[model samples]
Target: MSLNGKVAIVTGSGQGLGFAYTRELARQGAAVVINDVNADTAAQAVAQIEADGGRATAVVVPVGTTDAAKALVAGAVDTFGRLDILVTNAGILRDKSLLKMTDEDFDLVINVHLRGTFTCVREAYAYFKEHNVRGRIITIGSPTGQRGNFGQTNYAAAKAGIVGMVRTWALEMKRAGVTVNSVIPVAATAMTKTVPYFQKAVEADERGEAMPAFFRHDLGFGTADDVSGLVAYLASDEAASITGQAIGAGGDRLQVWTHPEAATTEYREGGWSYEALQENAGTLFTAETLQSYGEEFLPLPEDLKPAQAAEAR
Candidate 1:
């Protein structure tokens, strides 16, 4: 899908997935605004896009503030004449177990990933309403949010909150012909390098070494470019009907995640007593009836048993 004459503002576009999204949208004929906290990286990204014959400008500002977010949208309109798309891809990692996680760590991640997305979308939605444009808002999510990860309470909570915002905004903006969606990516990037196994696999791939058989099934699927293609499609007009959805992109795999719903319900003619609930709770909340939210990707060696894995941690 072509995005000619469209103007897109991608936050944290100086590097990683945000950069990939900005470049892809620009390459597809959109004027992109590169927003990042680092001025040099933002300028470098703009320069690279311009060198490739794409139109782009840089906005070096932190995304977590209301003022900064408004400035970002204003910059886009001032530079490109209109705002059409917003990609909230700025985030930070502050992984720690629940007991060990500090308030500052939790607040920082939420500020960047969840609140930052909210501020940007809020500003962009105002602009879209003022101009009567059918804008597209794409927020970034993470697998850790869908399936909880160890030592990542802050990051997982922030990512999950982002998805919640997307769903709510999608419903609110539908009448205005604007669309909102979330993209959960599982690509190998600098952010994923924090995990020791992922770092080793990336380093090995860079050295032209083959990954072990255990990791062969999933390692080195694709980079940020692979994720950007899905984001670009969602930004295009063809995906106008596709809102309030969470999409996953990695390597060649694209998936539509199921929305939360009631699997089953228990009711009575009158309010049940504590004794009744205590007796029936066993059957109502059985392990077999509950959905699992554990991590699916086990990067551990196959020879490691459950007990050994626990011990290793």
Candidate 2:
């Protein structure tokens, strides 16, 4: 999956998973545009990529505004001559339970993760159309969006919205040869380290200690690089056939998430009243047919190590 001569843009590429993606993409021979709100971090990332013999330029754009997004795309074209791939990885965590979450919290997360993705993709689409480029768009998604998480109502909603955008854009751009997809990654990056258990795992890893069993699943509680490989593959030409997908990349596991479907359906000759519906409630709503949220798909580190569970408690 050599990206030689390809020009790519990765938003929030100064640190964490975005940085990993930018580095890997540049390593594959693409001239990368690194966009981050922090000018210093963006310069450092650009310097590091250039130091490693990869071509990269920094663009300090916050990513939610239309002008900023357009400038980012324009900067890539001005610097690299053309654009081919876009990774909408800029995000922030404004976690709070629905009851406690403020309007500000909800709006910030939505603006950065959901609206930011929309603005970037919209600008990129315009550029791709003008240039007749078959662009690859890889949006960042989260498992919290697929399966709701406690105290993350806002974050989950925004992430899920990104996937919806990917689906619609995939259809809209299919005839133009542009592909849109989302990557749901779980890696030990700055974002994941915000969790207590993961913070411990990261600290332990830094000290050269063995991680708990749960953190060692599949390929282990790996670093950002572990997730970057999948993103790179999707950005490459080989993945042109794969669009409108939400792929999971964490540890050594790669998963294809099932799309929404109707699980059950019933028909009535006319509109049923509340009393009529109540008569068939038992058959319509059963315990086995109920859907649940807030269940952890992967075990926590403390769960795998009972002795340390006390600390987590």
Candidate 3:
């Protein structure tokens, strides 16, 4: 009952990680608003919660539209009488490499992940402020946001933007006792299942397609429940002091860190003179470079299966 009597809204809760979060929060005595673009899934989620002796209501909020997001906030507050927790978890993936990515692909992801989150959080904050209620805002991010991934430029960028928004909002909302944070999760959900590469990985495991020796030691694919545990914590009263932080939870692991480390100043008072910068350019490009260079690139895993590898094996 960590979140007892709290009212929460979880976007995209019809299935996957979002549904798990909604169910668990309600179980902990929080009344939850379950939102999904799919009407049936949202209704089913609410039904399951009610059957378990928990309180919940489901509403459909299509991804990427401001009107849908505003309506969702209104519905949650209208049903529950107030809002305490907001989980901005709704998103979609238009997988493609940057070269192959269309403007539409990029915009679609941004609209859902970035703009959609903004709409929900913005309206939720207004309600919180007007009611003089403290609030918790948790956004769903990804490892790709921390480390760039091939074929996920749009997703990565949108997630990275969430981190930025969290940090800025944390500062702005501090006086109002509103906490903002992000969670980076990896789970075996519909989103992952739909990814051909991930699906292949799961199938390969089932078929003994080069099962690694580490499989015995390593925790297997995470379920939605696993990620929901962290979500439950962040939504609780105990977590009020924690804000502007990211918790990476997946594969039964949790990691917390303050990102965009501060750097030593080599930025001298002068326009970019090639010679002056060259002297301390190395220092300038330390771990904390410009915000534009938000994330660092990592090489792909040696065991990663390429398209050709799938064909060959």
Candidate 4:
């Protein structure tokens, strides 16, 4: 798990999960580019990594912008001479149900998650392609993308989009030897813990008021480090063959295969037509409909059913 001589960039590394990823990668011998909107936090993170005898430099930029994304890559290349790994871990949440969701809220979330990820991936792809380099791209996804969660319509859609992006990029970059994958992590972080709603959810669960089926006490919940470990592995050369994958990581648990179940369906032919299509559309669209759309197969082991394991962790 040594990243010796590797040049890596981690967005939102000023704190939380991104910070953990940056520090860990630096500690593993990779020259890290720490990115965040907060200059002080980013600088402090880099300083801490350096204090631990790790190589790191901070780049203050809002990761959702295209220019900033390019700057992040350029900074990595300029500082370390090459770009090897990228972790697009910058994101924000504006949780709201579809009905209650505002356009501004939706735009903000999409800009951060989908647009932000696109910005980073596009720049990295250009670098990797131009340099004829094989790079590793790992994005942060959420369980909300796997199983729908209440009050997170925007988050879920964005996360699901990331998985789709990874799949497409994996194929597009295959010729260049780059691999694209996403990590669907369940971690307790500042973003989650700081949210009043989230705190209530956790408190409720603790009081046995509305425990999620996957709740587990000994699993110690999830932390930033837990998710970073998986990100590190995905970016490693050992995982070269593991592109277009969505993995789950946490304490006392590691479920790499997280996807919707499958089923058969039908579609209406053209001219048979608007009314008929409208009536049958709901039946045609389901998690089952999406199962065959991707190339990777990472379904969980039969005994490790996700629904049941919800209790263990």
Q: Pull out the clashing pairs in model 4.
A: 213-310, 214-310
Clashes per candidate, residues 3 or more apart or on different chains: 0, 1, 0, 2
TM-score of 2: 0.92
Pairs with steric clashes in candidate 3: none
**lDDT string, candidate 3, 28-134, tens digits:** 89999898888888888888999999999887868667687778778877898888999999999899988999999999999999998888889889888998889
Candidate 2: worst-modelled 10 consecutive residues by lDDT: 298-307
Q: TM-score each candidate.
A: 0.90, 0.92, 0.82, 0.78
lDDT of 1: 0.86
lDDT of each: 0.86, 0.86, 0.81, 0.79
Highest TM-score among the candidates is held by which one? 2
Model 1 misses residue 164 by how many Å? 1.1
Candidates 1 and 2 compared by TM-score, better number: 2
What TM-score does candidate 4 reach? 0.78
In model 3, state the lDDT of residue 308: 57
lDDT, residue 43, model 4 = 84
Which prediction has more favorable TM-score, 1 or 3? 1
The ten-residue window of minimal lDDT in model 1 covers 302-311
Candidate 1: tens digits of C-alpha lDDT, residues 221-282: 45677789999999999999999999988766788988888877889767679888897898
Give lDDT: candidate 1, residue 282.
Answer: 89
